[model samples]
Target: MSTDVAALTPAEARARFRDGLHVPTSGWCAGYAQANLIIVPKDYAFDTLLFAQRNPKPCPILGVLDAGETTGPLLRGGDIRTDLPAYTVYRDGELVETVTDLSEHWRDDLVTFIVGCSFTFEAPLLQAGIPIAHIDQGCNVPMYRTSIRCESAGRMAGPMVVSMRPIPATRVSDAVRITSRYPAVHGAPVHVGDPSRIGISDLSRPNFGEPVTVPDGTIPVFWACGVTPQAAVMESRPPIAFGHAPGCMLITDAADTDYLIP
Candidate 1:
């Protein structure tokens, strides 16, 4: 059986991730927000920040680290280079390797960006009595690259990426309402209902994360995803980039409620 992840504190979660436990962060640290990691060479940092600003929905930046720094004030001393359970290294737009730590790959001129993750909204949805299928199934939420293109920022330009969940038709509105309050965490559904409308042919096959069952009477709901930046990396073909493995996020000290809008 899997551990009781939902009950772990942010520190405990980071410890587990740093210790080589590659677990999906869907329901961990229930009231805290999980963040996507992006490490870019100093030369590409400005364009990357611009890319995020232009595409806030898919790339809501929560915190950024100074060049060569491994910790952020809001991340509770967690090392950006090793706190995430797994990381993907991209070399000129191609995935090079997935590793547990960046000690060997760390650079003095690299900057880290922490982007808000959709996982932040999962807890609120469950609190409102909505079921997150992937959590129950012990899998990562399914994600896909859409035909929709993101606005260009310098060398960063590519199609948008989205994460999908199956929400019962009756609770779709509630899910939207709950998520909308957290704009810093990829707010609201970008698309609801037909997957084909967004150029997603098969729900079973996702560009990232795992697919979950879409029960009867439930419709597929899509949200802007942090993976959008990874797609941009592929398009822009930056010399090198580092990002968290899909579903393996950095659990931050910040609370999810900090992102809720009045």
Candidate 2:
């Protein structure tokens, strides 16, 4: 019998991903946290760090692995290059290719930054009776590059990216209150309702990830996304960089409660 993907432990989930099970990670490892990945040469590490510091909403960092290091407290007994379901490679401001593993591209000077992902807070949202449309539809949460620009650091500069979830109008306040408690993982909705206000012309056409259905009476909610770093990478034209494919995050051993306030 096949194991339930949602019920798998963090390590088990990563093991499957390491073995080439490609899938979005929004609803996996329910209570554990999920993180976004960004790898860059050490020469550019300081800029990446500063970028996260300057734009905490969209780039709150969970943990950073030293240059050339992989296994760490957040992801014990695993390789950073292969643990995530999928990875996007970039070169000189252009998305080059995506791969399941980075063994071939690994370099001694590369540093890995694990940024906070909103998916970490989804478990709490579900526990509070807020429905996550992507999870319900078995698809990736919709994400788009917003007109809001992040506070840049050194060569790191780009527009902010956001992930969208449709919340029932009746529960929008509850959704905001619940998520506001976890600032480390994108605290609250950046924009609620009206996608065009943020420069997103169509909900059906997302810059990244798959679009989810917005049920009637539900208002669209947008959260700062960790993919904001990848947007910077693209804008800055760093010679080389790597990031987790949107919605395909790294399932960390850390509990979601670690980021929960109160």
Candidate 3:
């Protein structure tokens, strides 16, 4: 809940992340777009890319890196290996560890992919007079794994993931119209109201991220989450894979407006 971190510019924020400030990227660089990170061996790059292509709502590809590359030009000077606050390492479908830096994990055959995060749209929502419960509560957005399955792409396939926000029932349409402007991000609610309809039995406990208070007169809104890639990793079980821990997105230099649809 530090306003100091939230006030930093994208470059300054990334400088801290590079210097070892391991934390979630929410509410930082308020007008900039944040992204989810995923790295896989080149051998599985195609399958991962295909998975993203087939399921853009849950896995919108923001940028992709060639084998062995760490810097991504499309992200406005962000470094793929060190920009994110924390990374989750998986080996043969099992989570092995969560680390802050990827320098030691770097390999010549690794390819990195950046996925659009809903954080990019939060700024606009706030500006548009929509309430974001998690931001107001100063916590990471709640995310859940749903029974809804993603289309298979070679070895990449799994259940779709979603991030939830509590919206005032009166403003649900405004939330949808404003967020739908950014297709590069998740771009709008995939589900609303009851969590059980999407297979989420508990709203108090999320599969990833912290749960928030849903006050009276508010309805739950869900958007396809960037963490969907992790579900794919669990099912695809690539020999090796790496991704950003939920809420710990890569703060990019790109403006939030950059992704807005005209």
Candidate 4:
């Protein structure tokens, strides 16, 4: 397997996952849009949609599938149950298991929400010469559960989750300006510098994903994470919910340029 992951099309990458390639999808299919997944029973669908509506930064929805519908515009012919590299299953708010496929867990009344992912903007960030530590380190980006709570929507209420990247002191502004153009994919940094201010006491350990090396001259920058829905599921605990494992996004057929604004 000497394939270049970044060069593969979204369909090809998804095919690999369907065949059991389980891995975090941060840097794969470099020029395409990626998405976070959140599935809930039809009973909680409205509450979940309202949650995303109330919190756009972390839950910017790309496309939604009807109850029991698997494929849609964002996915083309792909099946949500088997397309992503990994899936996180939550049982009554408790993370039960992580799996490569969701075939066994399928339900007739389930609705899937495809949320925009920060990885969609990483290409532009790299083009602008802003280093993304996790990609360079070949690991999952660090994600932390912050002290800040998101605006509540019905039974969906929980703390905001954030993904961190160490930006050099000099290019922090450049990173912000470049990313702000892509609001659909989490836009700019929410909180820059001093992770402690947001209740992250240790950079070495993250609540989700692997921590990266933060150089001496680099300042840790955070963007609202798509993982916030998973947090909501944890706190609110609907009967059962499904999400892409943090950083293991569903690579969409849409081009990254589609989300960019002038």
lDDT, candidate 1, at 152: 100
Q: Where does the lowest 10-residue lDDT sum fall in candidate 1?
A: 1-10
User: Per-prediction TM-score, please?
Assistant: 0.98, 0.98, 0.96, 0.98
RMSD to the native, candidate 4?
A: 1.3
Model 3, 23-138: lDDT tens digits are 77878888889999889999999999999999999999988899998886655576778887889999998999998888898999999999999999988888888888887887
Off by over 4 Å in 1: 1-3
Per-candidate total of colliding backbone pairs: 0, 0, 0, 0
Full-model lDDT for every candidate: 0.91, 0.93, 0.90, 0.93
lDDT of 4 at 242: 98
Q: Enumerate residue pairs that collide in model 2.
A: none
**Model 4 agreement with the true structure over 1-262: per-residue lDDT tens digits:** 1139989999999999999998888778888999999999999999999999999999999999999998998888999999998999999999999999999999999999999999999988888888889988989999999998999999999999999999999999999999899999999889999899999999899999998989889999999999999999999999899999888889999999999998
How do the residues 138-207 of candidate 2 rate in per-residue lDDT, one tens digit apiece? 8988899999999999999999999999999999999999999999999998999898999999999999
Superposed by TM-score, candidate 3 places the C-alpha of residue 64 at a distance from the truth, in angstroms, of 0.7
Q: Candidate 2 has what TM-score?
A: 0.98
Task: Give the distance in Å from residue 251's predicted Cα in candidate 1 to where it truly belongs.
Answer: 0.4
Flag regions of model 3 displaced more than 4 Å: 1-3, 75-77
lDDT of 1 by residue, 1-262 (tens): 1347778889888888888898788888878889998889999999999999999999999999989999977777688888888999999999999999999999999999999999999889988999898987778899999999999999999999999999989999999999999999999989999889999999999999988988998989999999899999988999999999999998999999999998
